[model samples]
Target: MELTANRSTCIGSGQCVFTDPDAFDQDDDGIVLVLRPQPSAGDELARATEAVQICPSRSLVLSEQSA
Candidate 1:
């Protein structure tokens, strides 16, 4: 799976960072940053999905990586 962040829409809630610190982080301005653009299966994928879902600003996108 691929995890992407849209800093423009971030609200700095830190939910994504809180949800999965290994997969996400916040910049100095608290905008969402994707630490792991492509998460591996199992726990990593689960956490990525959770992070995407919990982003209040909908700034995260978890999608199937295109071929």
Candidate 2:
């Protein structure tokens, strides 16, 4: 799973952080950041997907890159 985030679209709701801190975080300015751009295709995938869905501002996205 590949994770990407748009800091400009974040609302500092911390949903992503709460869902998967291993894959997402908040910067000092309260913007969402992608901590793990490409999480292993494992348990982290589910949490990452939830984080993307729970983002109120739709700042987080996941892509299934062809490997």
Best by TM-score: 1
Pairs in clash, predicted candidate 2: none
lDDT of each: 0.87, 0.85
Best by lDDT: 1
Which consecutive 10 residues in model 2 have the weakest lDDT in total?
1-10
TM-score of 1: 0.94
lDDT of 2 by residue, 1-67 (tens): 6788888778999999988887787889888888888887678888888888888999888998769
lDDT of 1 by residue, 1-67 (tens): 7888888988999988888888788889988889899999999999988888778988899888999
- Per-model TM-score, in order, reads 0.94, 0.88
The list of candidate 2 runs beyond 4 A from truth reads none
- Clashes (N, CA, C under 3 Å) per candidate: 0, 0
Please, what's the RMSD in Å of model 1? 0.7
